[model samples]
Target: MNKKQKKMLIRIAITAVMLIALAFLPLTGIWRLLAYVAAYLVIGYDILRKAGIGIIHGRAFDECFLMAIATLGAFFLAVWTKSGDYVEGISVMLFYQIGELFQSYAVGKSRRNISALMDIRPDYANIEKDGKLEQVDPDEVAVGSIIVVQPGEKVPLDGVVVSGNSTLNTSALTGESLPRDVAEGNEIISGCINMSGVLKIRTTKAFGESTVSKILDLVENASSRKSRSEAFISRFARIYTPAVCIGAVLLGVAVPLLRMAFGADAQWVDWVYRALTFLVVSCPCALVISIPLSFFAGIGGASKEGILIKGSNYLEALAATKVVVFDKTGTLTQGVFEVTAVHHNELDADKVLEYAALAECASSHPISKSLQKAYGKPIDRSRVTNVEEISGHGITATVDGHSVAAGNAKLMKKLGIEYHDCHCVGTIIHMAVDGAYAGHIVISDIVKPHSAEAIARLKKSGVSKTVMLTGDARRVAEQVAGELGVDEVRSELLPGDKVAEVEKLLAEKSPKTNLAFVGDGINDAPVLTRADIGIAMGAMGSDAAIEAADVVLMDDDPLQIAKAIRISRKCIGIVRQNIVFSLIVKFACLALTAAGITNMWAAIFADVGVMILAVLNAIRALRVHNL
Candidate 1:
């Protein structure tokens, strides 16, 4: 337990001992009253002090004030009636303190899950200095500086591996159990564990701008952005507290006076006791605590599932999303090109593939890799020379003493080589060898395994429309859209055009519905920011994409979108249930107290009993695995 909880436990223990001692004592009159008062003060001194301070500050309508008024009035009634038994008053305060402690414990447990993120902050960074490793504060490490991450050490900053290889334990960041293998040229994010090997990393971002810092900032500031339900509860508490206090006063004073004027022997003490009971029942602790707790638990649960919701407001907004828009490249497709087919070859298909691979051997483009993979043989670099890369076209190089040009239709037109369009749906790389038309190879990106399933799940989850916007050609985009079964497709869109498309959809969508856009590129940042809910691919997405997104899918799984929405909906449902149930029960108990149909015991049930039940319901938000 924390120091605060320890202190509360000590107070509870002392109060319990004193109450037991008072029960065993044979004292009478003022002495017995003093012993009961001592027990009450031991447990409730803080509540009394807070009530006084609140009254002095003109904020006297909170639970502390109600509790203080109710318990002290009970004690006063006992003394004025010449009854020395103040046990009922002391029991009320003691039970109330016990309830408050229970609430503190519940909230602390919910917060502990989110607080696990604190372990991600690295204490030090190892930087290379003059061929020796020097440990420095993470804040002191500069961008572009080389940092060495040892085995079992946390990656202190986001960077690319310059040397060495290792399997990274990304469970803390991604919530995935499988360790990720990384070699030279792989980019690694901060907060992951370097599991097995020593890695020499060239830092790409400083400590403040790193992924870990951004995530921490997001989680810390999330509570300040309240959901609509939480806002309503705050407004309700402010107006409800003061209004109930006034009602209680009128019930105590005005009702008895008016009854006396009517010639009825209405007991003032009885009316005062009823008013105290009303005050206790009117306390709004259940709604005040549980609403925010439910949302907090939902966000914590989402984080554990590798979905980062930036705020409770966004978590609530996610539940209203009826239209989900997607970017084609990196979002739905694998974004890795592979050779699909070859046609119109004058020579053997192997010879044409060999020629293209040789011409593009020195290049690092996806298309080049596809060609080299199809060739299935290493190129003799000595046989190739005089390589020239034509921007937006392709390349020209000398392969085995023959001049070979591999490019698009534009490149063939530039070379004056008459070439036939492949009429294929995939990207066609046209080729010419020794000024003769050769075969073309078809390359295309593979759709993600979960893309179709995710779209179907979103539809099942009540998403009204699924749309895709892409910079790819119409044929390619349409093929992907058809395969994924999206409702609409907008192709050949630039980054600015994507933002416009999202805005257009935003305007055209139902007024009650929200538009969510998912993308994983730096160019998609603007659109991500423009959408109502921006979801980013956390694992392979760019820093800009992650920064602008409101929701992040840590493993880059599209299905998590539906899971996130379900979690939010469940949390909001719980909030509404708590609000309606608590208010109804409280109002009913308040009416009963005013009519003399209920007493202090029922008042305790209305206040503390409802709060306990609401807290239990709020804890259900953490159970998101089944959802």
Candidate 2:
């Protein structure tokens, strides 16, 4: 508990003891009233102060004002009637403070859950200077500077490992318990702890642009984006508070006047007591506090699982997702092309690949990189000369004095060489050496192990449709879509084409449901922005995609998509449950209080009891690990 909560606890204890002692004492009249007033001031002075401030500021329609008015009126009625029954007013304030303390503790719990992520912020970066290690603020480290990460130190910036290898504890970043292994040439992100070995890294991004910085920014600003439900509650409270206050005043005056007109006793004390009871029961504290707390707990719970929801609004929308559109590469698939097969080799397979890798060595395309990776050897670029790259075709270069042409069938047809087409479910590269058909290499992107299960889970989680959008060939796209169990596939699409497809899906779906687009490429940013919710693969995703996305999966696992949806649905379910429960109990209590069927003690339960239950229910949004 915080200092404020501890102090409130002490005040509540003192007030309770005083009430208990006063109940036993045979005190009378002015002495009894003075004792009760002293207890009230001890427990509720802040509330009275707040009400006074609200009235001064021209905003006197809040719960504190309602509470102040109800208790003060109860005390005044007791004195006017000479009943010496001030216990009712003091108990009302006492129980209200108890409810407030529970709320403070619950809010503190939610904040702690999110603050766990804040521990990832690094204190310093280890930069080598003058043959010694110098610790400096991460912001002071420039891109391209070499930094040393010793054992048990966080990688302070996004960079590439230039020397040494280590096991990284990535739980803070990805929430996965397993440690990740990194070696030379591997890209390492910030906020991962080096667990085993020392590593020298060449910084690729400054501190502000690093992954940790972006995630911190996302978390800190999350609460500012309120859900529609929260906005509605805000508007409702603004109108509801003042309207109830007016109704209380009318009940206190109009009911008594009606009795006098009927030639019966006015019974002003009885009618005014009912009015005070009405105000207490209609305070709206349960609805005002629990709804936002539910969303806050939901966001905190999701962050614990490496799902970064940008706002409560996005969390609310995720619960209603009907269509989940996915970009194939780097989303559902590995996005890293690998040589799956080499066939129809006129020359040796290794020799054909060698010439192809050498010819395409100068190109930086993914396919070219795959070829080079398949070669499994360093390229001696000096041996290759007279290189030419054909747009939409391939590359031509002289390797070891032999003319090598490597590309698709279009390249072969354009070169007038007879090439044999291979029936393969992948991207095939036809190779020609010395103007002769040598062979072809097949490269294919592997699908993620969890992609199919992710789709299945989405369906089980109430998602009606799943679609895969990709710029890959129709054959490849169809194969991947089939493997992943997607309900629809839009293949061979450009970046703009993706937007049109999502728009079409948006029009086709019901207005009540939302469509989410998931992608990890720079080109995916536009479509990500156009969709109802954008989910990005943060591990290897382009910065543009992450920045444009509303939800980011730090581990880049497709299964997290389903998990995120489940978390949101559970949270929103709790929110609706709290709203319905609080309203039902509140209105029931209000009707009974106005009819004089319930007393001020019952009014305390109607106000504080309902709020405590709603807050307890709101805290359930934090327990999402099972979901």
Candidate 3:
């Protein structure tokens, strides 16, 4: 327990002991009244002090005021009647304190869960200088600095591994139990734990711009951006509290006068007691506290699964999502090219790759990288000479005294060489050796393992349409869409085209149903911003994509999109439940209090008991791992 919780427990213990001791004592009259007063002060001194401050500050229509007035009036009534009923007055304060304790405890528990999820903030970053390790604040580490992460250490910043290999414990960051194996050249995100082996990393970003810092900032500020429901509750409390207080006062005076004029022996004190009871019943604590708490907990819970929601408004919007559009590269696909098939002459497939890899060795394009990767050997640059790149055509180079060309069909035609059409889908690079058609290489980007599953889950989750948009060839886009079960495919789209497509989708979508667009490239930023909800693949996503997107899937898992929607729906459901339940129970109890059918006991339940139940219900938003 925190210090405040411990202190509250001690206060509760002391008050319970005193109440028990009084029951056994033979005290009466002034002695009994003094004992009750002492118990009340012990358990409720803070509440009484706060009520006094509220009154002095002209904000006396709060729950503290109602509680103080009701309990104090009970004490004075017992004294005026000369009855030994001090225990009832003290019991009211004691029980109210107990309810407050329960609230504090519940709020604390929810805060701790969120705190644990955000515990990825590293205390220090280990920088290596002059062959020695130095511990420095993460903020002091500069980009391109070599940082050493030992076994079991949290990665302090975004970086690429320069040396060594290890398995990362990303459960805290991604909620995945599987450990990710990392090697040289692999990029590692901050907030993951280095489970084994030492790693030398070159920092790619400053601490402030790192993934961990961004997520922490997002989670911390999420609660400040309230949902529509939460805003309504705020406005409701403002109007409801003062309105009820004024009504109670008028009822207290007007009711007794009306009864007296009717020739009935109306007791002024009884009517006044009823007014106090009315004030207590109309506290509005449940609606005021639980609606926002539910949203806060939901955001925290989604963050545990590596989903960062920008605000409660987005979370609310996600619940109404009907159409989900996705970008092809880096969002649904691996976005990495590989030499899938090699079709060539009788010279041999390895020979074709050798010519292609050597001709493209001087280029840094993705196709060049795939050629080199397929070659699987370091190039002999000395053997390559007179290299010339034809823009949008191909690259021609003299390798080992032989002219070689590696590019598309246009390049072969420009060289006056007749090339055979591969006719197959994907990127076809036709190669020419010494002015003769040598062969072709097929490079394709493979879809992610979970891409199909993500689409399936979205369909199962009630998404009406799943569309894929990309700047790839029609055949390739159609092939990928078929494999992933995407409902529609739009290929060869420029950045501007993507935004236009998203706008069209928005127009086609049904009323009150939102359209979400998921993308993970710098070019995807415009479309991400244009859509109703933008989801970015956080791990490998460009900074522009992450910044423009409303939600981020930290590990770049497409499945998280559906999970995010599920979480948002659950949170909205809980909020509606709390609002309906609190309002219905409150108004019913308020009617009972005004009708004189319920006493101070029912009023306490209406104010504090309802709040406790609502708070417990709000905490349910945090239990989203199962969903």
Candidate 4:
């Protein structure tokens, strides 16, 4: 614990013991009053000091001031009436102290949530110097510099793999709850754990500019951006605190005057005493504090699961997200290309794949590697020469003095080759030797198995529209889109075209409706930025998408995107409940107090009772993991 927190606990314990001693002791007169004074000071010293400071700063009245006056009024009345009831007044201060401690505990718990999320931050970064390992600040590490990450260490920054490979636990960044395989030339993001195998990462972003740091910054500042409900509480407290103070004053003065004018015998002391009680009951501390506390806890809980919501306003909006649009390839599918099928006529399947692999050996495209992987044998790079790459089609060249070709239909057609038709739903690559059609090899990007379930959960979570946008051909995009049960499909879109589609959806939104776009995080950055809510699959997401998105899903799972929305919906629901519940009780209690049907004791119950209830309710935000 911090020094201040420890000190407060010590003071609170001493005050509790002293108050009990005063009540139980046989000592009377000076000693008993002195004990009462000690109890008051122990439990209320902070309140008194704060009230004094607030007064000096020209804020005439505050919760602290109201509390001090009300408790003192109880003490004076006890003295006037010759009753041993000063304990009631002092107990108010004691309970106020307990309440303060309770608040501190709750705040500390929420702060711990933020700390735990940031525990993913790495303490050291490895740098290579003269063939030796050197430790340095991540900030001093430049892009393209090689950094070594050991097993079980948090990735210090975003980078591409230059050497080695590992299974990275990206649960902290994306809520995927799984370890992903990383290899040479693969991109790795910050805030993920290097689960196994050592890796040499070529840094692509500075320490401060990394995805993890940006997430930390956003989560830290989320509470400062108040939701509409929270803002209302602030305005309500400002109006209510002062208005109650004025009412208390008028009650203490006007009642006595009215009795005197009527020549009726009435105890002015009783009325003034009650007025002080009214002020204590109307402090508004609980309403002002607990409402925001709920949202703070909610945001904290989301952060723990690798969902970084930018602000309470966005959190509230997420609960209301009606339509969710997703990009197909990197978002719903395993972005890594894999050879799914091999088709060949007049030749063996392995040979067709071997020729295709040789044709694409020198090219760096994912499809090339996919076909190369299907061969499952090392290529004779010596024979694979004259590798001519044709843009917008495929790769071509003379391999072993044979005119080998492999690519989409466009490429085969360009070579004046006749390609056989195929029924499979995928990219059809045709091969030919010396201008004669050999056969066609079909390759498809398979969807992630979890995509269907992810969509199902979004429906359960209250999303009405589930749309998919992709640059893939209509047949390919639709084939995958159908399996996922997507509500709508828009295929064959460039990055600019995706932005235009997002704008069109936004324009078509009903009042109070919001649109969210999920993407591979690079090509879809503009659309992510343009939507009502930009949610990036940060892990496997492009750097540009991470910057533009308001909410980040660290592990590149479509399931977490839906999970995040549910979390936001739950948080916003709690916020609404607290707002309506607190206001109803507050307005009811204040009306009763004004009518004088409620006594000072009743006012205290009304105030303290409402606070304890609200506090318990606010802590519900921490239970988001269970939800």
Candidate 5:
């Protein structure tokens, strides 16, 4: 417990002991009243003070005002009747304080959970000066400067490893417990801990633009964007509190006057006591506190699992998503292209690939990179001469004093050379050596290991439709779609066409459901903004996509998409349950109290008991690991 909660606990204990002792003693009227008043002031002084301040500030229609009025009215009724029964008023305030203390403790526990998730903030960066290492603020390091990260130190900035190799612990950033291995020339992000060896890094971004900083900014501002349910509760409490207060006054005066008009005894004391009971039963504390707490705990829990939801509003929307749209490259498939086959070669397969890799060595295209990767050897550019790059076709060069050509079918047709067309679902690169038809190599992007399973999980989680949007060829797109079990496929689309497709899907779906678009490229930014919810892969995704997205998957796993939806559905379910349960109990108690069927003790349960149960249910949103 925090210091304030500790103090409140002490006060509650003292008040309970005093009330019990006064009940046992045989004191007379004045002494008994003074003892109960002393106990009431000890437990409820702050509540009375806050009610007085609200009245002075013209905001008297709050829970504090209701509580203060009810307890004070009960005390006045007891003294006027000379009943010496002050226990009812003191017990009401005592139980209310107990509920407030429980709320404080719950909120504190949630803050601690969020604080643990935010422990990735680095304290310092190690920079070399005068042949010695000096620790400085991470903000002071400039881009392109070299920073040293020793064993068990956090990488303070986004950079590329210039020297040494190490195993990095990325649990704080990705929520995965496995350590990632890094070597020279590998790109490393901030907020990862170096677990094995010393690493020298060349900084690529400053501290403010690092991944840790952006995530922290998103989490800190999440509460400002409230969900629809929270806003409704706020409006309801504003109107509900004052209306109940007025009803209590009418019951106190109107009922007694009606009795006097009927030529019966007024029984003013009995009627006024029922009014006080009604006020106590009608306080809206349960609905006001539990709804927002559920959302806050849900966000905190999701952060621990590497899902960064920008706001509670987005979380609510994600739970209602029935349509999921995906971008093919870097989302459902590994974006890197690889050489899959070599056929129809006059020389050896390795020989054809070597010539092609050498011919395309001067270019930096993705296809050329794939050929070079397949070659698995360093190229000597001096061996090639008379190089010519044919536009819309291929490259022609002399490799080791032999004519070498590498292109597609159009290039062979232009050269008047007969070539065999291979039937394959990939990008085909035909090769020609010395004006003779050589083998063609096939390059294709491999699908991710978990992409198909992710689609299945989404379907099981209540998603009705799944679509894949791609700028790739129709053949390749359809092949991937078939493998992934997507319900729809839109192929050979530009960025603008993707937006149009999303708009069409938006119009086609039911109005009550939502559509989410997922992508990981710079061109996907516009479509990401156009969809109902934008999910971006943060690890290798472009900066523009992340900026426009509503949800970010830190580990770039498609499986997290389903898990996020499940977490949100659980949270909204708890919110609805609390709203229904609190309202049912509150209205039921109000009816019994006004009819004089229950007393102040029952009103205490109607307010404090229900609030305590609702708060306990809200805390369940913080446990989401198994989900």
Candidate 6:
């Protein structure tokens, strides 16, 4: 409990003891009045003071007003007896204080829950210095410093492997209830636990610049951005509180006068009691507090799982998404290239590889990198010269007096080199020696293991269709789309072609159906921005991609797409439940209160009862993962 909560609990205990003593003692007149004063001072002095301040500020109608009227009425009731019903006055204040304590306790519990989620933010990082571990503030730790992370410790900074390896339990940040494997060259985000092994991670980003830091910053500010449901409750409370107070005042003055004017014997005291009870039931404090609390818990829960939803507006849009479009490379397939096969004529495969490496050394295409990697040999660089690039085609470079051309079939066709043995699944880069057929290297990218599951999960989340768009040829695109269970495939697209395809999908969207686009790192920035919800895959390493996408999956696992949709569905469901529950109960209680059928005491039950139920429901947002 916080300092404020501890103090409230202390006061509650004192009031409870006083109540017990008052019930047992048989004191007379002023002695009994002094007891009532003690009990009221212990429990409700602050409330009385608040009422007085509200009166001075010209905002005197609220819960404080209700408490003041109820307690003071009981004091006047004490005048009927020897003690002015001082015991009843104190007891009512005591019960009201008990309810306040319960609310404070609940608020403290919810704050603790969220604070536990934010535990991912570490206080310091251990920078390796001359083989000794030195502790420093995360912000003070410079980039390129090697931070040592041991088991059960959070990765305090974002970094790459300098040495050692481990499995990271990222439940605190990514909400994936699984531990991830990390090794040399693997990148790690801040806030994940080093479940095992001692890691010497070379920090790629400073503390404030890390993924966890940015996420913490986003979540900390989420409450300031209100959802539609929260806004409604705020406006309702504003109008409802003052209106109910006005009704209560008119009831106290007009109803007794009406009876007296009609020559009836209606007492002012009895009508005043009813008016005080009406004021107690009209606070509207509960709805105002819990509505925003629900969304706060929801977004906090999502942040715990490594999904950064920019705002609640995105959460709402994500819940309504019906069509999900995906970028082929990086988004679905492992964006890394590998040599799947080698086809060569008039030379052995090794000789073909050696020559291709020399020619491609002058270029920096992904396929060239794969070729150089496959060759497993270093390029002399001196053997290569006069490198020239062909737009959308290939590169021409002279190596050891031999003219080498490396590009797609476009260059092969343009050079009039006849090679018809090209396969459909992998990228085929043709090579020409002085404009003649030399050989071709086939590079294929493997699909991510999570892509298929991600697709299946999206289908479960009410997504009607999954589409893949890529700049790769139709054959490669078809091969990937088939493996990943994509419903539609648009391939052989340039950057413009991808944009046009997104426009087409937008046109096809229904009034009720929303469309989402997922993409490779930052290259699909334009398309990611165009979709209803732009989810960027592999959010951990690329700051550019993370900024462009509305929702970022820190680990770049496509399966998180489904998880995000599921979270949105759950959050939106909870939001709807609260709204429906509040409105139905509020309308019924208000009707019964306005009608003379239900008494003022019953009105208190209806108002306070509904507030308690709504608050309990709002707390469900914190436990969303269990749901």
Per-model C-alpha lDDT, please? 0.88, 0.92, 0.87, 0.80, 0.91, 0.78
- The TM-score of candidate 2 is 0.96
Candidate 6 backbone overlaps, count: 8
Clashing pairs in 6: 78-84, 78-85, 79-84, 173-306, 174-305, 174-306, 175-305, 538-556
Q: Candidate 4 on 80-133: residue-level lDDT in tens?
A: 777766678777877777677777788888889878888877788998789888
> Candidate 2's residue-wise lDDT over 23-76, tens digit each?
999999788888899999999999999999999999999999999999999999
On residues 114-216, what C-alpha lDDT tens digit does candidate 1 reach at each position? 8776678888999888989999999999899999999999999999999999999888787778999999999989999999999999999889989888877
In model 6, the runs with Cα more than 4 Å from the true position are 49-65, 68-70, 73-93, 127-133, 143-153, 160-169, 177-188, 194-203, 344-362, 374-406, 414-416, 431-439, 487-513, 594-601
> Candidate 6 at 590: error in angstroms?
3.7
List TM-score per model, in order. 0.95, 0.96, 0.95, 0.92, 0.96, 0.86
TM-score of 3: 0.95
Runs in model 1 deviating more than 4 A are 128-134, 344-346, 361-365, 372-382, 388-392, 413-420, 539-541
- Candidate 5 lDDT, 245-298, residue by residue in tens: 988988899889998999999899989999999999999999999999999999
lDDT of 3 by residue, 1-627 (tens): 789978988998999999899999999889889998999889888988999999999988788887888788888878877887776667777777777788778777778877876788998988777888889999999899999999989999999999999999887777788899999999998988999999999999999999788778878888877789988988887789889888788778888889999999778878887887787778787887788888888988888877888889999999999999999998898889999999988668999999899989999999899999999998999989999999999899999999998888888888889988887778999988888888899998988999999999999998989999999989889999999999999999987898899989899988899999998846687888888888887443256755788887877789899999999999999999999999999999988888899988778866788899999999999998888
Q: Would you list the clashing residue pairs of candidate 5?
A: none
Give the winner by TM-score: 1 or 5.
5
